[model samples]
Target: MTVKLTNIRIITCHGEEVIEKGEVLFNEKGILDVGQRVNTDEHEIQEIDGSGLTVLPGLIDSHVHLGMDSSPDPFANMKNEGPEDIAFKAVQQGYRFLQSGITSVRNLGTRYNVDISYRNAVSVGTVVGPRVFAAGSPIVMTGGHGHVMAIEADGCDEVRKAARSQIKAGADLLKVMATGGVLTEGNDPGATQFSEEELRCICQEANKASKTTAAHTIGTDGIKNAIRAGVTTIEHAYLLDEEAVELMLKKGTFLVPTLLAPRLILDKPGAVPEYMIDKVRKIIADHKISFQLAHQAGVPIAAGTDAGTPFNTPGLLSDELALMVEYGMTNHEAIYSATLGAAKAIQKETEIGSIENGKAADLIVVSGNPLENIRCLDSLVYVFSKGAIVHHAPVNKQEKQEQIV
Candidate 1:
């Protein structure tokens, strides 16, 4: 059905320009146009009076784990969760994100290739959720970071096989653990897990299959090694030093900073793993600082929340943009990171990032101007996914009359 959203303010991330009295014209296929006073027949069109709302390209989360649920005590859940249980929970989480206005996401890890299956389900209309690009499983050394969730493979040959397994399982990209993680049993978050040669081999294998790689690295050395090995994106460079920052700038690698991950684990008033608490305390300060270094050096910073991790809510990726603004980015820059910058990170820039006429009409309407206040994203008034009005916030009694013109 054709629809026209009129009398709204549009923040087009194409160049961070704002259009007054903007109209978004769309149909089942995609967006038809976005501009001021778009000429359309009012009689047949479903006209939405968005006089008090602001429109933006639906937010994109470049890094998230859908299979895990992000309650306060996620350690127990991840430790004992079964595949069927995780799958069921993921279905709920995916829709929750959609209702919360996240239109696209990248799942970096999951148990039993569930992420790939979820993505496929969304594609085939068996399930309804946002677009998902998944890494079926991550590659980790035996007894290293995320050993439980990842495929354990050591050495060059084993690493290559691991990469192939994720690709074979239908991963859009390959995720490799370049360093040990804090939450894993008997692992040090500050130590490197994979050798440079093994990391390079995995990248080579992924490249041969025409897939990109995301490195889960926390230590400075591990971040450097992953950059030298030519990984496509670096996740959680919490301890990035000046040298590591220099390498990222040199390689032109984008950093997917899930800043909310550690903060959530550290601040939650519940029983977290002792190791996790300690790790967050030790690294939280530097984690905040690393984003500054990358932002200052002009390294592309994309908005991602390690959702499904301990206390990192799935639909709360918008909150990360607020944090990004607080940390150093302007409101427009923060919004751009989650929209266009994230699109570029996933190599979908030509398709889903901007408000182009031919692009998919995955967009959201907030209660206020997000370009003025980033937190406005948390108050999404409407969510239009692929030209369908999937969600609309409840209107107050006083505001109901506004819907009738």
Candidate 2:
């Protein structure tokens, strides 16, 4: 069915521009037309009055672990649950992402190929969720960070095999653990795990299959090593030095700054493990500083919350974008980070990044302009995924009166 949204403000993330009083026409397949004026047949057309609404491409979360629930001590919780149980809970969480106006998500790491299955389920119309790009499972050093849900590999040859295994399992990308992490026992967040040689082998394997690699890196040394090894995007990156920033800029590597992950751990200290809290407290300041340095240095930054970690709930793209603004980015830049910037990080820019002709109709209609106040995203009125209305909320009379007055 054809649908047209008329008389709306369009935040086309194509650049720093907005189309006022524009129209967008789309069907289940893709976007047909979009501009200040769209020519469409009146016959059998479903028109939605978009007055007082701002329409933009839905958010893309570049880093997430769907199999891990965002509970205190999620690793312990996962030990108790089976794969079937995890998949069921992940499906519900997927819906939560759609409700938050996230249309595309990249599952950087998950156990049991749960994300790959979810991706297939969404593709075949068996479930309703955001477009999924699954890594199947991350390749980690033996007893490295997130090894519970990752493939443990050692040396260059082992990492190469692990990368191929994920790709063979239908992974869209390869997730490699470049350093230790906060949640894992006996792991120091700044300690490098994968050597540069091992990282290069993983990246080469992914490149052979035309897939990108996202490296979970925190320490400055590991960050630079990953960049030198051709890793596509660096996640966390809590400890970036000038050299690391320059390397990323020179290499054209993207940064998936998951500021929300550590912040949330600090916010609810008692709710999470004490060890996790300690780790975050040590790195919180450095994390923010790294993000600011990278942003100021013109390193490509993509918005990712690192959801499914301790207290970092899924479907919180807006919160991450808002934090990006607080750090140093302009509102336009933050929104782009989550939309087109993130799409580029995951290599989906041509498919679902912005409001353009022939692109997937993954959009959201919010009550206020996000470019002005990103918190306005909280008032989402409609969420469209692939031209299908997945979520809708009626505009009450009081809200409409305030808009008019």
Which has the greatest lDDT? 2
Model 1 whole-model lDDT (C-alpha atoms): 0.85
On residues 1-405, what C-alpha lDDT tens digit does candidate 2 reach at each position? 788999999999998779998999998889999998999755888899888889999989988888789998887887677789889977988999999999889998888889999999999999988899999878999999988888999998788888888889999999998999998988998998999999999999999999999999988888988999999999989999999999998999999989988888888868888999888888889999999999999999888888898877878888998899888788899989989999999888899889999999999998867777788887889999999999999887579556434
Candidate 1, residues 233-255: lDDT per residue as tens digits?
99999888888888888988899
Q: What is the TM-score of each candidate against the true structure?
A: 0.95, 0.98
For residue 13, give model 1's deviation from the true position in Å: 0.9
The numbered model that scores best in TM-score is 2
